[model samples]
Target chain A: MPLRWPRRLGLVGLALPWLLPYAWMVSTSFKTLPELVAAPSAPLPSGLNLDAYAAVFEAMPVGAYLLNTTLMALAIGLLQLALALPAGYALSKLSFRGRGLAFGLVVATLLIPAQVRFVPVFTLLAEVRLTNTMTALVLPFAVSALGTFLIRQALLSVPPQLIEAARLDGAGELTIIYRLLPPLLRPSLVAAFLFSFVYHWNDYFWPLVMTTDDSVRTLPLGVALLREQGTGVRWHIVMAGNVLLSLPALLLFALTQRQLIHAAAGKAAGR
Target chain B: MKLLSPRRPTDPYLLLLPTLLILGCFFFYPLLAAGKLSLYSWDLLTPPRFVGLDNYRALWSEGLLLHSLELTLVFSLGVVTASTILGLALALLLNRPGRLAAFARASIFSAYIVSWVSVALLWLWILDADGGALNAALQRLGLPGWRWLSDPRLALPSLAAVTVWKLAGYAMILYLAGLQDVPAHLLEAAALDGAGRWQRFRHVTWPLLRPTTAFVTSTGAIASFQVFDVVRVMTQGGPMDHTNVLVYAIYEQIFLNLRVGRASALVVVFFLVLLGLTLWQLRLWLRREGAEGQSPPA
Candidate 1:
């Protein structure tokens, strides 16, 4: 219960192991090739360098890829929000037939990995003449089972009294969901948005399956391409690429970390 | 707060429209189409020919799938163990008292933000045969450079190791969230009663962390099953296909072999296996729920 250093030293010592790999990673990212090869337990770079970073953007369509990734992530996040928020509100609050089954179906779909569905999805896209397009990458993920579930949980926390009062006041279902739900569910929505965006930005499987060229590649897929390029593994560029790859989500995590943790913890408590 | 209307009878359905529409077009349709394509041999260019269960029979008999399934199990088990142990350790560590603990949490989760492809790249460099960081370090230390990726025996384990390295932090973050809700006074009380650290942790802390452990472990296991990027980028399921898993096998089936029907069968089987595992987890959850609900006064 004390705030003194020794009282807290054990706790801080616990974090030391976690800090090691990242320190290595960040240290390596900053270190020169000579330094990296010189010692395994090399110290942090004497100073930061931008050469590897510059090469990362130069070697491939890093700029376009980043732009594509952001836009696709944003598009997917917004679309999921648009689709999931309402459907989740409806499923949570509405008295409707087949509601249980609909909810069950969504839960069931959570078990179907995108990899399992990739082949057929690819074929269907080919049939629709949509292969190798950014749309192919983003469209399938626009409505997420995870988002729907999270939003429903958020909506369930809204009082029935609120809905009942709204209905009694001649408010329509759509209006109640848009107005009543958003105000109450803002935190959940924000959490979902950040989660979805970061997740999509980091997703590799679907984009890998759907797109072939660098022109439409997402960041994760782009990073994969660097490996497949057969230029041999370039450590510095790869480190730069990883830093670039992780920066956005890393930044987002840093920014909204408190809220994200709250949401995750709340959900863990079965909220 | 404004209360919007359900005055329109179709509003609810409209609200569900985008979700259902996207699910149907993107998800459900492809799943159904996957089933349909599995029954018929058609590789995009060919006219569809009905070959019901022929593709399924082939993959089942070939041992390609059985091998992949085995590898997937091994890979999942390895990653699950490594991730959980390291993650739990990290979680416990960061849950301690100190200023750097906050920074430690951030740094650990920073690993999660790295794309799998990049993580694979990072490890690939680490395991490179010639002048690789790890190999170079070992040689410098007068030790043998372990041929991690190239050795068939090491391939799956190496993949698992890389995956664990990538995900341990994320799992730690989840467990950290769980740790935060431990009702700290319990630990304080336990300490006052002559309880040593490990005793308190084992009897009180670990028990409370069950839900979080269950969440992290199950999610980690399931996610590991989809370990295609690492396999693809790092080894491409090579070393004589020693590292191949179900996802990459399915990938090879459809893209490389151009066998749509067979690939679809793999899809069905893969989904069923995952579904079975998930159902098992759900059953355990329900039993836990039932037990909790029926428990005597605390």
Candidate 2:
């Protein structure tokens, strides 16, 4: 059946609210301060200005924040992948005495909200004087229960004969994991990578608790700090910083749209 | 017994050691530490003095702890209900295979993937009292601008609204995946029986989507209870603490007041509440699935 024009219009109308803030963030970033402050509220900026973007860097150590965030995302994603791959392989493919218990413990970690661990983790880090360091930011999150679960599910779905054949060829477990599994588990690996990246990239709370200085602070915490440190309401600069902080993820998301959708659907199916 | 024996049966245990070590140190160890710390009274400066249940008692007697917990519950309820309903509606509307629908679906889902810090700031600008997009639109419609985050009464709802807007995309994606699993033949059969649209949805679609609903609601509730970034960015649990959720309260207790003991107690409570939620939802989900499995043929 041909969907009517009115229904199409309705869908677009509903979608507008979701789309507008993004447009607003971009637009407001380019707007002059007076235009932003003007009472009537112009929908678009009268002139294209690069002032706010410039000011964002000048006002704070935004470049360092961005770098720190990128590093954290990459490090955390890789670390989680490293930790999860073997564990997932073991949990799914191999027989061990504590297999069920190990799997259960990994799953149980999912139920423990990361927020509840904030104080104690912080305290532990403090005890070792690891607080306010990049290690502190990335270390606690190195192990991912969700990643373990997803990878285990992926490894389980692979035919047992593939690994069996490899084992028959005198392949060690590490060799099998390194060569055989990577290609097989590409999609779940991608999903896990994306999930961990997105989560740590946008993580504000743990970083906020752990880092006291800009040298190690990630983008989200830096942006919030930018707002708090502002003497007056500077929407343009703040919006500019928001766009800067959000752009990498948005771009990554837009580029990998199909894979992301497939990954999400796969996850939902698993659930 | 060689250390690196290739055919060793303990290979799985060896493989899982790194994960277990990290989780043990970070997750399990911290949990035990939190449990112990909850019973003591310490400000970071002083050595923790054991005061069994005093921190927990203080949390109840001081009353702000309860207030924050109540606010968290109310906030989670509002956001979960609104987001799930809106998400389901949008998913239904946009589930068809058309260019327009695809565009709309992508547009709707984009919000959820963006950073919450950015989402909070963008909405902060939109919900600004003057020159804000929302107030501006309201003014054009001849309505007076209202204090959204500034007024205590409106702060929690404003936070809830922002949360719903951000999470709608996540819920929509989940529902869309769930919708795909609903058997088309069953829907066709219901339609052939001359069932109305609402009747088909209520009886056929709704029942089929229960697992998805359970997944969505349970996860939504858990995430909402752990709400922190938006509140930290938007309100800082301010305007007379109307928007102070449990996580934010924990942060405040630990950082602002240096009440690590009380904060640890709060964390324990938060953990238990979350665990309880997961278990409760699991029970409900299992029961529903069980009932469906045992149902007589339609």
**Which is the leading candidate under lDDT?**
2
lDDT of 2 by residue, B189-236 (tens): 999999999999999999988877877887789889899999999999
lDDT at B283, model 2: 70
- Candidate 1 lDDT over B39-71, as tens digits, reads 989777888899878998888788887898899
Q: Under CAPRI classification, how is model 1 graded?
A: acceptable
Tens digits of lDDT, candidate 2, A1-271: 9878888798788889888878888888898777766642678888789998899989888878889999989999999998889888888877657778988899888876679787888888898999999899888888888888888877777887777788899888999887889999998899889978988898888898998887898889878777887866688899999999888888888998877777665665563
- Using Cα atoms, each model's DockQ against the true complex is 0.43, 0.55
Q: Give the poorly placed runs of model 1, Cα more than 4 Å off.
A: A1-49, A164-172, B1-8, B181-193, B289-298
User: Candidate 2: which pairs clash?
Assistant: none
True-structure RMSD, every candidate: 4.1, 3.8
Kindly list the per-residue Cα lDDT of model 1 for residues A136-245, writing each as its tens digit: 98888888887788888767667788878888898866677677678788887887787778778888888878888778888887766665664643666676777777
- Residue A214's lDDT in candidate 2: 73
